[model samples]
Target: MLFPVALLGVVLAAVAHEGHVHDATPDTVPETEFQSWVAKYGKQEDLPFSGPLSFSHLPYAKCLEEPDAKFSVAVLGMPFDTTTSYRPGARFGPFGIRAGSRRQRPGRGYVLHYGFNPYVSGKTILDCGDVPISPVHNGLALDQMEVAYADLLRRPIANEEIDRTRSLALDGVEHPRIVTLGGDHTIVLPILRALHGIYGPVTVIHFDAHLDTWPAPPGIPAPYEAAEITHGTFFTSAYKEGLLTNSSIHAGIRCKFTGMEDLEHDVEMGFALITTDDIDDVGVEGIIKKIRDRVGSGPVYLSLDIDVLDPAFAPATGTPEAGGYTTREVKRILRGLIGLNFVGFDIVEVAPAYDTNAETTATVAADIVHEFISMLLFEPKEKTAESDFRVQAGRNGDEL
Candidate 1:
């Protein structure tokens, strides 16, 4: 009788547990409710902090890998810094700049100054990813950059509505413009070589604390030919190769020099100087006049070294100078040159290992790149082959 009573109690407890489990399970939603749930949460937006990394969260494509890919502008990275003279970590600059652009997105890409969103300007823009660079060999890395840049430069433009009159296409066929995230200042030498192939010599507007035109010293000899291609001497090499025109100019220059002969040689290599002190003397408008008057309307390439900013504003560059232009001044100057035909652009020498907790250096670099995108997509209402009213209009209070 006792065993039978214990069995009956166990059965009752098992039935009670099963009943509780059945009551706790949720019922499936009706078909209409299921569709509403899918509509709310099916697709994920490209949020700043949650999506795959790309510049401003633009679409990513391997331009080198896909021959048929179409884009009007591309952001290419050259992660080669084997030729840097001082710092060793600028090879990581491309990744740092991308990370610093986390707060920017295509939906919020409106520029208050320019009053347009480049992402929606009827142009296909892509982050074409980085060129594969050899870390151990400088010669191979330089060749890799040159070949990669030339290939990308020759790709057909995706937009049929591109105004050819405002562009630098020597042939009637439209070509894509590239903004390179650099490895070091030395990367410009190969880039100039590639541009020379298509556009002949181009006018360069160099913004740097250093002249970057130094040649090998009179007595010393390089152990190898590639050893002569340091970041400090690339402009001289470009000059030797005839990759520059006489209209090129330099701004924010305040680097230490051996003598006045450095300025003389810089002039011979086709550059006029605007020192950091000149900003205080001539003011921002005066500097804008100087750059616009010098570059005129031509195929121009702009190269900006991160050291052009005061170390207070940007301290993570490979070389830092004490006094330089403020970030606002640089942006103003860039805005003032809106009508010039820009064929290419670059910002280099950001060494993230030396950056601050706020990542000021890389963030500034990314902002300047944002400015580049706006500058490219801008179209003037009244543009002519002989006159640059667009630039004069920007200098005044007119929208571009």
Candidate 2:
């Protein structure tokens, strides 16, 4: 059975081995080349999936035909949104983001594995499916999440995360990379919980409208309580729980939801605040440099709450700020951090219900994912040129 090498979750590269799999663009290359590459790398013993490989046909969920890793990235969709204020549809964010991410220009979308072609490179990514959730049952969801993630966290790989550094390795797959598509900022807590347990005291790059540093505030009636373990209270708990390196370096904060005490507590707790006003003063390049300087060479987990995109760009978030970076600017800032010690990122708070035009939030989130993969995966100038071309949108910066 053949698999669709769509994204880089689990790849299907064209090797010169018999019985290997291959995915090639229609009419782009001669059909003979596909078979040739397969003959080289497609060994029957090295296949990722076998025996009536089912579920590999699902749009967002698929099993690899041959379980081998070439720097994998697991993109888990955690669409559970039990705690939200003023917005209730972010549970749809992950699906919306995936739906909008199907971009394949005339030539592109493959480089990391199979030089400038997806089929040749294989999809170097994996969809971990949605994190087990209970949309209607909060406690149950948390319980299920605790149990499920406890299983993940308990894996011996979590103990040596950086050494392994790929979800495939953690999941006992070959050495593959991992990227998480989040349902909310709170999802970062569990990821950090898993990561921190192994690579203790990693620095966090937080991009959001609010500080999210409030201790468990009183539970509010609608959406969420300021203090619940929902989206809003996640960071506070993380700091207390010691997930972040004391929750340091929060960028793109335009609005303040927590009191000054919490704010001050966050600061004393080692959280560095980067205001929208400051970002405005310094360009994204400068801001990224500042963040890199502060963080130095720590293991980085980027947490991007889409509300930072000023309501004009990302209005679907529960907490939208008036003045913030344009989506382009946010991409630029993140671009500068490319090649830095970045582990993974979560673009949270995209409530599709708020956006009458689904493109508004989905596009932002998808673009974020694209730019992230572009920065994290794509190799440098000459290599990228020789590699497959996806979109011609001119991305300039460091590359491996």
**Best model number under TM-score:** 1
lDDT of 1 by residue, 1-400 (tens): 9999999999999999999998885788556886788788894567778788888899998889999988888999988788888877888888888988888888888876666688899899999999999999999999999999999988888886554433455665677889999889999999999998888899999999999998854554556777888899999999999999999999999999999999999999999999999999899989989998898777899999999999999999888999999999999988877767788889999889999999999899999999888887777555654345345435444433
* Top model number, lDDT: 1
Segments in model 2 whose C-alpha atoms lie over 4 Å from true places: 1-71, 104-107, 110-123, 146-176, 218-227, 257-259, 380-400
- Alpha-carbon error at 150 in model 2, in Å? 6.8
lDDT of each: 0.86, 0.61
Instruction: Estimate candidate 1's alpha-carbon lDDT, on a 0 to 1 scale.
Output: 0.86
